[model samples]
Target chain A: MSDRQLADWRNHALNLESEVNKVVVGQQTPIRLITTSIFARGHVLLEGDVGVGKTTLLRAFTRGIGGGYQRIEGTIDLMPNDLVYHTYLGEDGKPHVSAGPLLMSGENLSVFFFNEINRARPQVHSLLLRVMAERSLSAFNSEHYFPHMIVFADRNQVEKEETFEIPSAARDRFMMEIPIVVPNDDAIMEALVFDTKFHNVDALVNTVQPDVLQFDQLNAFSNVIQSSVEASDTLKKYALNLWKATKAPLDYGVKVSGVDMNRLVLSGASPRGMSMMLRAARVNAWLNERTAVLPEDIHAVFHSTVAHRLVFSPVYEMRRTEIAREMLQGIVNAVAAP
Target chain B: MKTMIRIFYLLLGLNVAPQTAFAIDSQNLPDVPPGIVTIRTIDPVKLVGYTVGDIIEREVILTIKAPYKLIETSLPITGYEKRYKGQVIGIELKSVSHTKKENKDSATFDIKLAYQIFTNNVVAKNAALGPEYLNLINTKDSKDLVKYRIPNLDIAISPIAIFGQVKIENNMSPLRGPLLLSNVKENKWLKVSIGFLALSLLGLLYILGQRAWLPRMGGTFAKTHRKLRKLPQSPEGLKLGVAAVHESLNTTASMSVFSNNLGIFLAQKPNFSPMATELQQFFSLSRQVYFEPNAAHGLGTNPQQWLQSFVRRCRDCERGLTPETSTQKSGS
Candidate 1:
């Protein structure tokens, strides 16, 4: 891409970042990850406490980029077809069929946010993962396509009963599993509490000018940025070492407190996850107007991009979030930065 | 006011004026002895042999009858200029020594006289102890203080040799050395500095051990791990190990962390972030072992061994030594 086009793309990303920041007070990390994921042509899985503005951030994200926004709340009885098609009775006393939210937006779908995705049955996950993998769905007579879609999903973490977990295969589809944390700063918390506009998520999202980014250019720009951002051989070695550290943390001297090095990792970042990290890092470098991928760029996206893909020992599964944060941190810190 | 001032001036005048005095007639003292008492020079004066700065010596003896106290009035007072008759002798009386000896009939008193002369310009002349008399009084009512005189002892007064002819040395006489003093002393500052140095050494040792700057022997976590490791491979041993790791983490973070609050606890100590995964596993194993013992054995992980390593990591985090650093050191 030309320097001018790169600059324009960076401005659009910054605009969207700020536009989401407008509604989601003190959510800079989630906003940045979402923006990076958007530019990388990858999906994001947001996890946080209820009322942390995960949905609202995605809404503002869609509004900022001027793309079709579709939300589906996952439930125990939700079927795979429920996301693809809906059946209802009309005034004519005859059944009518219509495209579901996923198909309604078709090729213009930019953000298909799945709320409480864990509550959805494994069947729904299989369907969603397939479509997320292919960006298209097979209907009765034709194929419903969403070539520009980025599936943004969130799972309920508070309750565990009656929830069907998104299996590991489905989880690997996401580019990042970013946690939306509550703002700890008292001033931000007070503003979020006392500011009336911040309470109106719909209005806050409406203030954003739609279609600030050309979603159609997102794929091409992602490819160009990934190729243009030069990562040195040393950087590749560093990234490779990081990958090795995750799989067998003991081999690369990755040690987490309260865990054994030899038995800590059941598995590590897969090849797809590693490449996805590179892609995200490239987009990050492009956003920062850097022609080369810096170590800090990789480090910036490392935990979110690569942490979720790590599978810890079964005994440590419950601590995945923490281990993910820490083990990934250990890998990055253990591996030498180029 | 004028009249009062005049009266005050008249009183002041009266107070300042001199007045005439009455006199008392004194008669002859009653003699306790029939004969008069006289003081005579025991030895002739040697005035010619002494020069200026030399003392003139004289021996005087006085005898009186029994029960009569002789009062000698003619003795020269100390610091007074030496005089013979009416002439100043250019000498001063330096000292006087008196002695009394009891005899069977009368008490005899002996006196020694000394004088210092100032001038050496005098030619040979006659000097005297002069005529001295004593008063013998028996009654208090009698007239007293009668005159007594020391008799004159004829001597030739002479001057010293000419000043230039007498040679003088330029330096003073040889002097003695000063008294020896002890050298033994206490150094409070040195002692105090040594004390502080000892304390500083102890502080350095403590810091080195705490930071593991040097190789540390078994500390709290190490000892706990050892204790757990020594326990038999029983369910009780596994449970103990889990509890030990849990306690170590709680102590490190200063809070108890459940499976869910691992993030919260790790947040408190980012240094322990590396151990978050292990802590989670420990918590999960603990839950399995404590709450569902039946399912714990099949969980595949040996809870005891996992706890041992996890506890050690907590110790590492507490020491600010990342496992990678440890592994690097070990690898090296």
Candidate 2:
């Protein structure tokens, strides 16, 4: 694409963000990250409390993209085949088979939201991982492709009982794991509590303009964005150092209080994880209207892209959210950029 | 002969009165041969109020017949302590001098004596100059000799102060010691010490000063400017130069500072706040050089020169000085 065309698309992307911003109050960062993930052709994992507007934020984004939307509720008994097809009784009392939510959308699927994903069984997670990783599924003697689909899943970190934790390999397939929280702004909190406009979720989600971005062209524009945003040797080295720091934080002088540096990281971000990080950073640069990726671009997506991929020692896994935050901050602080 | 000797002594006293004002009467000379030592006179002037370190002068004169000449060896010597009743007193003869005049009938001798008081007394006491015995030998017969005795002169020797209350204003005398001591060398050393202290303080100020006028306080940005100046205009050189500046900003802020947090760095170090726009441009230039090397340089014909000037402005800000060209915009 020409520079002018790229600039126009960048404006459209920013417009999508503002459209979502209209509905979701005080979540500019997560909205921007989700927008970047859409442009990068990667899936996102949204984690927050039960009612911080996680689902609303994704719905608002899905409304803006506008191709096909599918929603699923993760339950304890949800099985792998439930995402593909289900059997129902016909009106004449005979059995009938119907394609499930995942296969019903087919190739037109643009946004797939799995709410409270941790509530699902590990077997369901294993099947969802294949769909997220390859954007395709093998079921019912056919291959199904969601070439335009971008999964946005949310799970509250408040509950532990009867919850099947997503394995590291499944988590690594996600490009970012962004956290949504209650807006600390007193005015926003008051609005959320008392404003009649915010009291209705469906009405609030309808406020965001639909079809602000072309879902069909997103994959192609992502390729253009990744190619146009140049990463010089110095930036590449900086990214490489960031990768090494995630692996061996002690070598980079990264220290987390009361955590042993030597045993903190059981495994670091994989090669695919690093590549996805670069992909997201390039999209961030494109969103910011830059022709080259700077260290700040990497920093904008560093924790979200790499933090989830880090497999911690089981001893420290209970405090993963807090420790991972401090560890990533330490890595960026300890490593210098050119 | 004794009466004639007495009359001659009176005549000699009359002659000595015109030559010396301190002449005193010499009477009742004992054990003196008649007509041999006919005339003699002694003067003890101002005999009262003598204290330690005070000098007393006595003048003596004698006329002896021609056959008997006064023996010079019998005169008192300097540093001779006087004795009273076989005990040595503190009074010592500090100096003595004599002159002789020869005449047809007899030889006249004039003698002067100075005695210094070395005694310490709590109260005023009577002190005296002890008498001296002089012998005259006859020239016609070496064995013939005569003795003449000079009477003692009694005087009062006082202490440095009286036993009662002494008032300085009333007792102001010309004989008092000086009040102020000599301090010429001490004054010279004090001036030198003050000069050295002032110089040391100035040196300390220079080392710890926040201004660029001082050598050591040129600061982090100044050092970075120097590093940039030495680099070439090549692509690698520009990259290295930008890294050097990034390093300096990080060191100044004590953390990594990118374009986004430049405001926080400025807020923490407000001296650099004036160059905020320029610093932002520099970060843009840094991004271009490090991340978009193939991209055209935005900083005019000579990027290295522009970088040098930009770093100089940053150096000025580091020194708490407002750069003259701070208003000038970077081409980037």
DockQ of all candidate complexes: 0.01, 0.45
Best by lDDT: 2
lDDT per residue (tens digit) for residues A15-38 in model 1? 878877777889887788899999
Chain B alone vs. reference chain B, TM-score for every model: 0.35, 0.40
Query: How many steric overlaps are in each model, in order?
Result: 16, 0
| Model 1 Cα shift for residue A169 (angstroms) | 1.3
> Per-residue CA lDDT of candidate 2, range B62-98, in tens?
7777787777887878889888877777899999999
Summarize candidate 1's per-residue lDDT along B157-199 as a digit string, tens digits.
4556543434324211123124456544446677888999998
Sliding window of 10 residues with minimal summed lDDT for model 1 chain A: A329-338
**Model 2 chain B lowest lDDT segment of ten:** B22-31
Give a tens-digit lDDT track for model 2, residues A1-338.
Answer: 99998989989989998888878899999999999999999999999998899988999999999999998999999998898898999998999999898988889999989999999999989888889988999888889999999998988888988788989999998999999999999999998889998879999899988899999999999999999899988889999999998999999888999999999999999999999999999999888877888889999999999999999999999999999999998888777887
- Each candidate's fnat: 0.00, 0.68
